[model samples]
Target chain A: MEKKVILDGNAVAASVKESLKERINLLAQEGITPCLATILVGDDPSSETYVRMKGNACEKLGIISKRIHLPKETTTEELLETITELNEDEKVHGILLQHPVPEQIDERKAFETIAIEKDVDGVTSLGYGQTAFGFGVYPSCTPAAILEIMDFYNIDASGKHAVVVGRSPILGKPVSALLLNRNATVTTCHSYTSNLEQFVKQADIVVAAVGKPNFIQGEWIKEGAVVLDAGYNKGNIGDADYESCAEKASAITPVPGGVGPVTISMLLKHTVISAESYMSKKSATL
Target chain B: MEKKVILDGNAVAASVKESLKERINLLAQEGITPCLATILVGDDPSSETYVRMKGNACEKLGIISKRIHLPKETTTEELLETITELNEDEKVHGILLQHPVPEQIDERKAFETIAIEKDVDGVTSLGYGQTAFGFGVYPSCTPAAILEIMDFYNIDASGKHAVVVGRSPILGKPVSALLLNRNATVTTCHSYTSNLEQFVKQADIVVAAVGKPNFIQGEWIKEGAVVLDAGYNKGNIGDADYESCAEKASAITPVPGGVGPVTISMLLKHTVISAESYMSKKSATL
Candidate 1:
């Protein structure tokens, strides 16, 4: 028997934005406008386009968007100072720094500049540790979104073996930590990992985030395993070879339409949550 | 075919302490007094003994040991304030709070209070994250000691499967993360883990840290797996059945002789390192 299903990224993201309208309205009534500050440096055409899309999404959701654009020649100190200013801004509820800044600037410093409270993108190790240790805090948006999608699909992770390829601080590492928090035994594989196929074959759930175009072969996948390919490579190529893997996998998320849309939606949701947390604190004090 | 080699914890610790004295002398010539602060609450005889032993170790190594004794009635707020003060004090380099504080106090709060820079014990998430992410920072004493022991034995961990039993934040969690950083494929098992025997059976290296007596059975170990037991339970029992496993394993650390002495040695080493870092910073500014 053959099965067919279509995934729509934009429509799913739009639905999430619509769902948050009421919460945004409630906070607006309380005079607390949730604000997100996006810092973009050295306009890579792709980064510029992505930031613009996010800014547009924020507008549709009634979240105040504060856009900061720095030139390519901006020094690391200058970028850090700007981020520090945003961190101190009580009006700002969330901070997002569009990644892949100029090679000269320290990207990690820029990401860490977003205070733990305002780290809507949740790029800081502080944010990661909180989630990894099972403390109550925001997770990195993409990882949280991946979990949200899994939960939405009713995938049970309890006692499952999860193999996460790539251990980038943002997505793969935190996601593996999250899966561990949910009682799934997790193994993180990187370039140093020995026998990648052996580890991948043992996974009940496979999250491929290596960004190498179709690096995960279909033969390595265990039949009926859940596959999440978060890699958005050239021409929308994913980390997994979808054609062969999809045939054997019980459930799988397609590249462009799968994790990408959920990630954006999660970022929007974080802005609203940050605003609510700010409001709750204000009310508690009052 | 019999080896008559037995290790002594205190003597091994003394040897490490003596080796560190040269570094301590170099720092001293630069006007650095390596300081280690030991905070003990209540009068648990065992804790008192341990703290005193640390202080003595520091003294022998030309390090300054500051012992802070708080009453059992100390509030969590009081303890937190004390730790915060130590964190800010330029003179104080490393902070070690004796664990298992009074029942009324929050242990997590106590751990979190230690400044990331001053947390030589590596109990805080900041320390754990830095260690996991491969940053140059102090790891929890026991785990660091385990590494030191392994290195001393000249064991190559590259491409090896290292299975770590137990998932305590201090010893087990940090050790697995450390092993992973060393290019060992790591599997972290805890109370909730199922088929743990299977994971243990497949390891090139096995670390038993569950703190339960003989939690690891001898037959499950691969014939030539390197065994590192960090368990210190009642009656000098380790998680692994030492006699049975030792005969089968290529290299094994006996219960009392294995990891215990190295742990104390590493703690003192961190104290000296913390002090040296502070001293250099002060000298640079001066």
Candidate 2:
């Protein structure tokens, strides 16, 4: 077989950000800055790193990043109050609540408190619904990123058999919804799925979002299948056995630079979009 | 081969209605009658019959049925206004806008106008999201009916490979979400799906919602698989060629009395549930 194509996330991310620079400059002319407020309620090192990286990305793109680090013991009510404040704040174009808050916090309730307009991370139930219905302004970023990579690489999803492993609400479920909306015949598989390999072997496209390292093996991949791995495990490994699967896949995204970079870029893009929406509404009213 | 089991809809629907009677009486004691307000736009004979059937079902259960009939030329704005009125009405426990409004009406916008509290038919984008997340109050009736039948028959969805043929917002999509929530590995296929038979043959549970009579052929069925046909086509035929499929299937729902009766029962059940919710809130406030 000929050399397999590596789906480059950095290239996709760079292109995405490059396209946004012009839009960001337009907002700058209107004296408005695209702002994203990210709330981190715990001190998990990984979550902290993710937040900082997002914040840095925002700064790089001429957007404002407002980081709110709440103590681990914060109550759900307090979290709701903070979200309400951001919802009312005219300058905050986007709001993101980092996942895995303290055990006591009602996480879903807190996510619900974020106004739909500012839910840039797409954690809200309403946001998820809108995305599933196909008119959502901002889908959950990771799912959006998966599509961005596909679109960048010119991978057509329409009329294809795409098997998605894992069904996490943000990553797996939303991405499945996105692919389905694009007219792919989507099979959503999880740990409870029986005979998983049988389904994977028949796919035109395989999406690995199961989170476990090397969960999807080489033999599971069909010849010339397009593989998009959305997993980021310890030691930077993805859900699929990369070296082996790449041998069979016609196109595959590597772990470190595959989906993660594009995900942050999507968040930034959503913030800019939200800011533009606000500016347009402001202009209309003026 | 031993005879296949016929999944009887009348038996399941009767049981559901029988269970609701006591709850309905409790609401009556509280001086609250469960009410469903249905908005029917235009004079499509099929839609008219459906609305009337739902109204009749509500009356049979001692629930109030408020039917609003509008002309073919009704604009989206007029439909939205009617929905808003129902949303604000304290006595209306549920609101259902019959599908396939006239060409000029913005059907989705009108569906969105019904308040979340009154979206018993599960038409709104918000409701679809809630259903996907597994916390929806009322799922679209047909999807709910499909699950009700599965539960009624004690067929477990967990770990099963379910193939859903159709992607309609109200039927195929919601049912796929519902089955996924129940831990079934779900493949959502539509007309765009390639080699539809191969997917169907792999299913442990097959849901036919494609709206075309005999679309799912008998040869596509796996031996001993459970089939739930949600299609109601002309001449009282189902999506599945029932006679042929039944021979190869372990259990299947018949068209005329199958999913159809249970669907209306689910609507009635949802209206009563909404009324019960209303009563509890009123009591708590008191």
Q: Measured against the native two-chain assembly using Cα atoms, what DockQ does each of the candidate structures obtain, in the order listed?
A: 0.56, 0.90
Off by over 4 Å in 1: A1-19, B1-15
lDDT by candidate, in order shown: 0.83, 0.94
Error of 2 at B264 (Å): 0.2
Query: Which tens-of-lDDT digit does each residue in A42-64 have in candidate 1?
Result: 97999998898888878877888
Tens-digit lDDT track of model 1 for B215-247 = 888888998888888998888889899888876
List TM-scores for all candidates, in order.
0.93, 0.99
Superposing all C-alpha atoms, what RMSD in Å does each candidate have to the true structure? 2.6, 0.9
Model 2: how far is A116 from its true place, Å? 1.1
User: Which DockQ-derived CAPRI band holds candidate 1?
Assistant: medium
Best by TM-score: 2
Clashing pairs in 1: none
lDDT of candidate 2 over A206-259, digit per residue (tens): 999998998999999999999999999999999999999999999999999999
